[model samples]
Target: MEFRRLIRGRVDEPQLERIGREIAKRYDRESVRISVLEADNWLSTPCVVDEEWFVKVISPQNALVQALFTGARNLGVFSRGEEGFFERFEDPLAMSQHELEATRRVREIGLNAPEPIEAFGVDEFGVLVLEYLPEFRTLDELPSTEVEALASELFSALTLMHANNLAHGDLRGENVLVHGGELYFIDATNVRKDGLSTARAYDIACAIATLEPALGANCTVDLAAEHYDAATLLAARDFLDLVRLRPDHEFEATRLKGEIERRAD
Candidate 1:
């Protein structure tokens, strides 16, 4: 946790105040209330603005960390003899803009995504604003039974994403938020436009790893198969071991592999 904090860096109080002032200016408010969110975000400082806007204050360091992560993920894909798929931004503002566009695209495809507001640079930090969902629980915070009930919709949403030439790239518990009893995706990592197929499969693998702990291997595979065929699911097999290596994902890779094969047969 401490290491993560160091890598995420910090937005000092003065910078926070400046960002708040910018929000106030944008909304034509005399002042806006700002409160930092407790998140294990690797790329940006997330906060709520005036209780109405969800904001991310991204710094140069955050952009560097994002690039580093992208490089590492690409290397993982390369290890499996496939070209890397993840994309990286040049700087903080670009990172903010990319997320803004990605979130908007997700919403366009009939999925629940926060309404993207805008992206602007304040000093060296890039600020991203979006509509805030007042009450929400991350997928990880939900119980196993609740996760099971939501499994179909979750995979359904993922299918919608891939069918439309979109891929979440990063789909873990924290990125999947439950609000108003529906699944909303956030913090999508950028992937190569030409690599959507690989990205789609990788996303499926990540999704499987994410739900396996809660729904168990068989139930998770069954739910996934509702939208993906045996071949499509099999495409994700190469990324399973890679996804499992992520600390956020800890599932039975061997068990999932067996279930996926059984479904194929």
Candidate 2:
């Protein structure tokens, strides 16, 4: 039951191994190596194996991953389940098909994402291969200028994604990566297509929230106010308001908002 809470369901290692081996054979690789990234925890082991790239394996029993992969793929990202992995939990074939269709749409839009190499699902195994991005830093670790530049770029990308009727559902600090002076979105499993405006605004709020601490005293809300629109500001306000409501987040949000307001003066 505890594992179910973490991974959303049960996962069989043998099933995953079989699928990985099959995929390796299809790609003509010498061996399919399964490295368990996490075990004895709520989350299923996040594994990496030999292929043209890396495959992020999520247990179908995990509600969040399942929802994210399913939702994001529906909005146009490639996601699929491996064969013999988590088959008892859900329909892997349908999820994979939907993810492929989504990936095609995202590709058509020219958004930056890890190239989806292959996807397959059988039995309890489901796997998706994506081009690995090396030498990337999370938004929290970037320099102020780099963060600002990333904000500007994300602004443009978010606008484009919105215009094209897409919403990145989970826009969090860890999900953004900066490499080569460019911002790349990762973990796009929470994307949505229906509520573009709300989704874009939420993403902006999330980005601002993430960038504020890293920007420090030099970067204030007022400084950000100048860069964004009335609607965006409103959204940021709402986000800040929500943060203030949380006991754990109140101090940080208050400080950041004060800095922003001070910068305006």
Q: Which candidate leads in lDDT?
A: 1
lDDT of 1 by residue, 113-162 (tens): 88999999999899999999989999989999999888888888877887
Error of 2 at 43 (Å): 8.2
Question: Which run of 10 residues does model 2 get worst, by summed lDDT?
Answer: 78-87
Q: Give lDDT for model 1.
A: 0.89
Q: lDDT of candidate 2?
A: 0.54
TM-score per candidate, chains pooled: 0.95, 0.68
TM-score of 2: 0.68
Clashes of each: 0, 25
Instruction: Provide the overall lDDT of each model, using Cα atoms, as 2-decimal numbers.
Output: 0.89, 0.54
The window of 10 residues in a row where model 1 has the poorest summed lDDT is 187-196
Looking at model 1, residue 163 earns an lDDT score of 76
